[model samples]
Target chain A: MPTEGHTGRKIIYDEDGKPCRSCNTLLDFKFATGRITSRAALPERAGRESRTIPAQELIPGSKSYAKVEPPDVVELGNSSWNLLHSITATYPSKPSEQKKAEMKQFLTIFSHIYPCSWCARDFEKFIEQNAPKVDSREDLGRWMCEAHNAVNEKLGKEKFDCNFWAKRWKDGWDEN
Target chain B: MPTEGHTGRKIIYDEDGKPCRSCNTLLDFKFATGRITSRAALPERAGRESRTIPAQELIPGSKSYAKVEPPDVVELGNSSWNLLHSITATYPSKPSEQKKAEMKQFLTIFSHIYPCSWCARDFEKFIEQNAPKVDSREDLGRWMCEAHNAVNEKLGKEKFDCNFWAKRWKDGWDEN
Candidate 1:
């Protein structure tokens, strides 16, 4: 029962079932990279099974996996780990185009109301927790109104007063 | 001179002038739940005069302040240290829309290449550090190509033969 294994650089198989690459300690092929190669090389099961193909294969009109131009491998060792972590940690759950547009609009309109990151995050959380559950735009509007009012009350000001004041004064309001 | 400060539910002024609101200990004001009283309350001189505006005036449309709304005030209060750390560590740099779009595109493509969080983060860091400063679309394409190549080499297959490949393959050799 000879099994294959990897010793850092190249794939190797031992005749005496040794684990340690240098001293030939009894090896564990269960965790060996050669095990992966053997598993991959196993004969395909009979019949056309619905294969859970890699995402690359799922992409229509994609060429054979062997022929495509390879991504730069130099950075792949640690770069892939970095890329995946950053992407997932910061990934926004998929949203509709309309919702994204709305989010952007709100971000712009409420930009001043939330000058600090904490406040902005709070507002975003409030929207996420409340907006989707609401049934109608009217409800959404009311929620926003209440939220705006709540923030205003906290800050000791009336809602929409800034806009009103800017309109009335018409002279000194700095355009953001 | 006593300065008025709001302590949760009540407004209190510091009579002792003991730097109660130092740059670091100003989390109370930073995460305050007050309404935006007036953007006008912010002094124009605040922006021109200070590198960091007083935490009190960071309201939207204010002369020197901007507002940030977060989902929860309590978490904000507790986590203010980390948030402030990020604020102070990075210079205020606004990414262009083009850069934003490219980043988004890169993330979308990168997600498929390295689904694991760790791998994705590493890849993103590689791009951030090594990719050319993207001022134009041409630069973005070049960076994408470089990123693509970087990931391909890591899996030990000829660049672009793995499960997460991204290059387009031509049809002469494979078909024959």
Candidate 2:
């Protein structure tokens, strides 16, 4: 559905056909709406002297606001990793034939359709090169760790020790 | 793999433990591991003394510091919905037979394996009652809106109007 602004008035396009000053890519559309609604919950300009702040400007590099709240790219990426690893941790050690097939299919499709488009595409290609191993959950988890490390390696991040799977995700860490 | 704590110490289980006092359910040991790690991230001693706060407690509602934050159910759910609706918006208006079947299968398996277990279970039942329609993108989008509304109704949230699909996700709102 077309999202509504706070007021009842309909949003409209710019008649001047000027490029958006802030982001000057090819004006994506020759004719388009100028009512720039935002998904980010930035504040609205209240008084005549007030100026609108672009979401990007209010971010880390802004120098105006450093300690912004949660759910940024890095945090979201980590959360997704935590979730996927937990799922792998819970994967059946000895899956049924149907379950194995389902898991394999699920991973293949997941790589294609993850929300991060470029990341999804890269993972799809990676999967093609290294097809998933679904024979057992151990194999799957190990492979997943390897897969994650590969992504980390590409991004210049440190690799994780795959051997710690049980400690981190399943069994409690061995304190002794 | 065992996870290590920040101190490089491992977390351990009690040698001869009774059920944990905090959580009183029967130790699901026959088919479980009393490894008993918690995901909640609540502080150990929320409101007792000279302040040492776990990151989890700084979150709102947390007693210690109340600012701990990660994507909770609400944020994750909304992000998931955004991804799903965007996917539907991009689905081929006139899909090939293969594409149609793939999309249908994708939705079917998605409901079964979504990360939120309870949400997945509820969606599985919902899909059984309302089989998906994938004849065209419009059909798919409408189906998604209806399915989302069903969930919203269950959660006592407002229903979205399906008529403005293009205006919202695809073509920014048409002001004229």
Candidate 3:
């Protein structure tokens, strides 16, 4: 059975017939996929009502629950955002032409090879709609912030103020 | 004034003559750089003994301490690793030639555009020494684990067992 991701794309399956982990959230791929039909598969949640376990916690499994747990889509997405924002935060304020070209190239390749197929496709479309402005740190920072806000909006999360991209990613706020 | 990063590279300065945030940890760039000379600059730490504050906590500045804080080298590096490892975890078990080439291109671009100059240089050198092995998921995962272990070893951190790359990055432990 195939699962449809948030993007409405049918998640691809591995040789084992498990849905691709990178294309779907752990919830859709793990619990909702009917793979854990046996109560024995979820020892921690066996005796407890499913509602008691936070969805996020249930997916990653607490450290005590698993010795080593692979990151789900959410975990991967958040960390990737951290890295991307940090990159823009430190971008040269006045980049050389070569630097600008390289930055654009980097983004293009990043969008192509991002682990999350659906997420990457969405981002590629986003880039097509709003081409990266890599002329300066400010341009890049605002562009990335806007990009993040788009995701946030799609996820029904609160959007960050684009005005404070620098304060959030580069300099500490004055109040500190 | 310029400060030296853990990599021993002289942290570059911006037009304002402040040390580069990406090249140095927040400790070296923020407190140790002498830029925060006045007591007012450290509103939270001013009244207390510096020893009471954890160094990592001090660099990130608690949300209560600062409205928004940029990531230092440590924060950026950790997040970047999370993204990198996740990429390898989801990489195809038997990839196409195009996938292999694209992955290599992504790594090269990532090395060039990584926010931390010193860290990027080190990674570039590492890549040259050990070219990426992207033929299969197993090969790529082990290669990435070894690469991360190299950095971990340099930082005096415990090394991960490369044999368990799938357990750590893709499949949740069976014990879970």
Candidate 1, residues A5-57: lDDT per residue as tens digits? Answer: 33342223333343222111112232342333433342342222334457554
For model 3, the stretches where C-alpha displacement exceeds 4 angstroms are A1-66, B1-66
Model 2: residues with Cα > 4 Å off, grouped in runs? A1-83, A114-118, A160-176, B1-76, B164-168, B171-176
How do all the candidates rank in terms of TM-score, highest first? 3, 2, 1
- lDDT string for model 3 (B42-119, tens) is 344335423354444432523222253465455577678878987886678889999899889888878887876667
Fraction of native contacts under 8 Å reproduced by each candidate = 0.05, 0.02, 0.48
Tell how far residue A126 is off in model 3, in angstroms. Answer: 0.5
Chain B TM-score for candidate 1: 0.27
* Top candidate by lDDT: 3
Instruction: Tell me the whole-model lDDT of each prediction, alpha carbons only.
Output: 0.34, 0.53, 0.67
Candidate that beats the other on DockQ, 1 or 2, i.e. the better one? 1
Docking quality tier of candidate 1? incorrect
Candidate scoring better on TM-score of 1 and 3? 3
lDDT accuracy of residue B26 in candidate 1: 30
Query: How do the residues B53-99 of candidate 2 rate in per-residue lDDT, one tens digit apiece?
Result: 77653433334433322232344465566656656765678888877
Residue A146, candidate 1: Cα error in Å is 27
- lDDT tens per residue, model 2, A1-176: 12223333222222233322111111211112233344232232233115555666443333232222223223335555655665565567888888788877877766754544455677788889998888887988888888888888876665667776544544323232
Residue A175, candidate 3: Cα error in Å is 6.2
Q: Considering summed lDDT, which 10 consecutive residues are worst modelled in model 1 chain A?
A: A69-78
